[model samples]
Target: MEVKGRVSNSTGTIVQSEDEIDLRRGPWTVDEDLALINYIANHGEGRWNSLARSAGLKRTGKSCRLRWLNYLRPDVRRGNITLEEQLLILELHGRWGNRWSKIAQYLPGRTDNEIKNYWRTRVQKHAKQLKCDVNSKQFKDAMRYLWMPRLVERIQAAAATATAGSPTASASATTTITNNNNTTYNYNNNLNNSFEVHSGNMMLSPAIMNNNFGGSQSYTPENSSTGASSDSFGTQVSPVSELTQDYYNNVTVVNSNNNNNPNPDYYPQVQDQLSFLDCITSPSGLFSQQLDFQSMEPNTPWIQSNGDTYNGFWNVENMLLFQQLTDNM
Candidate 1:
């Protein structure tokens, strides 16, 4: 039987180098594996040209070795590694460094590629958590506990400029301008006090200020008018009362919805019990009727009740859940 297979090597007229040879390309089957293994066993695994000739196999030595190690090796564990393997890779890389191939050797099923990917992902995740850009100066400062003093001065100058234009700038505008002129003195004083309080352990980097205070905070009129003025220091200041009132009103609406149901148990345990009482009392007292029905006939009403009861129950539950979530906010 003249069974023909794809020719492993092109029979070229020119005797060219190995690089010039075109090996056969196809999926390896059990027959191919057996032939390759037998060839390796007989030849003792060296000299690709001689092995290919003697074994009647078409693959190069490098290809043969890759196939054997990746697929046929007895110790090569298959399938994906678990979360435990991922953590091990992180810890090992942190301690021993980025020797991925070496790390893969320890992880029976893990590939070097997998380890490298995991490391890259973990680094990105940590960088995000720290609120520092991996490519920015803040990230470098975080990694090395040091920052350019000139950069700090630039940040201070920017802060002074922002303070001058702030709403509070009207009240202590003169003091603020004077402070801006004498920023070096005030900065030194503040830095000294902060250093004393933290015992030099907590160095307030520009990164921390940028991350925490760069965004909006509770704006007090005294602070707003005294923009960058030391005179407002130690003064009683509350965030804009209007903002707080609006927040509370929104909370009240959510709370009202939560307590409208007859079934108080549906509401969150942390919900203000007093607000739940008010909700049940308000809105034409519908929940009162539901409460009466629930108490008088439990199992009988459960079957006979229309869709109204269920809808009201769920609506109230949803409102209560929203309130519970908002209360923390």
Candidate 2:
């Protein structure tokens, strides 16, 4: 086809620029496809204008690029998305929203267009099969249940950060809070049950450390009744007192009274405890909460916990406590 075109700048004046004036067309051949793919894989996508020139392809940069991506790419898996792939697409789309590219990341060899189409067709089909409206209140409710734990974890993490006073406090508190929140949120939202005892223990370490630091100055007894009260409260608050002593011992200046200090051994004990806590509370430790205990499906072993199976009152109370602790952290 002999195509005629005029090129102009913003002012509507006919510009004689060679870059704008030149136009090319024709069916892409094997040689063109090979050239385009080789150039792209080496140099990477984008800069389409330069691609046509440097790659020595007669086709326009747009056509060469589109052909390569939509058909000629080696990784492009050309087939219908299988049932397994469809489920993955639905789950990923539910979690990530309209992040088609990210969804593609999970489905190797699948194009964005393929995933998008599969979602539109298969999501609706499955929704109808389940006798539910894809855009209805129930569908949204289902999605909420699906993604709630992740959302809750993020909220708790933010709360922890806002309440944190020092870098160590902030880092340690945020991690602990997030871990606990993830456990609690997943258990409550998925399994519809109260999480195991470990949730409380997660908060115990950070709480103890904070309390110890806050009470450290009151370690010595004074003649005043106020001083006596302070010492009583300070000693009684072992967890908090231990944390404060550890913090001060790590950072505080040593003085003439250091040798005579009543709690000279306190800091080392707290430090040891902190190390023990750190060893156990690794990032992977959170995954245990995600185990689907009631799973019956052999291939897809993770079953979503139904709300009807657990006590509503306890769930509400636990969620409230989680929110409150997160807020005050």
Best by lDDT: 2
Per-prediction TM-score to the true structure, in the order listed: 0.30, 0.36
lDDT of 2 at 278: 29
CA shift at 266, candidate 1, in angstroms? 61
Model 1 CA deviation exceeding 4 Å by range: 1-15, 18-20, 25-30, 41-53, 109-329
Cα displacement (Å) at residue 186, model 1: 78
Tell how far residue 204 is off in model 2, in angstroms. 37
List the lowest-lDDT window of 10 residues for candidate 2. 190-199
Pull out the clashing pairs in model 2.
Answer: 190-305, 211-240, 212-240, 212-241, 212-244, 213-244
TM-score of model number 2: 0.36
Error of 1 at 24 (Å): 3.1
Backbone clashes in each candidate structure, one number apiece?
4, 6
Highest-scoring model, TM-score: 2
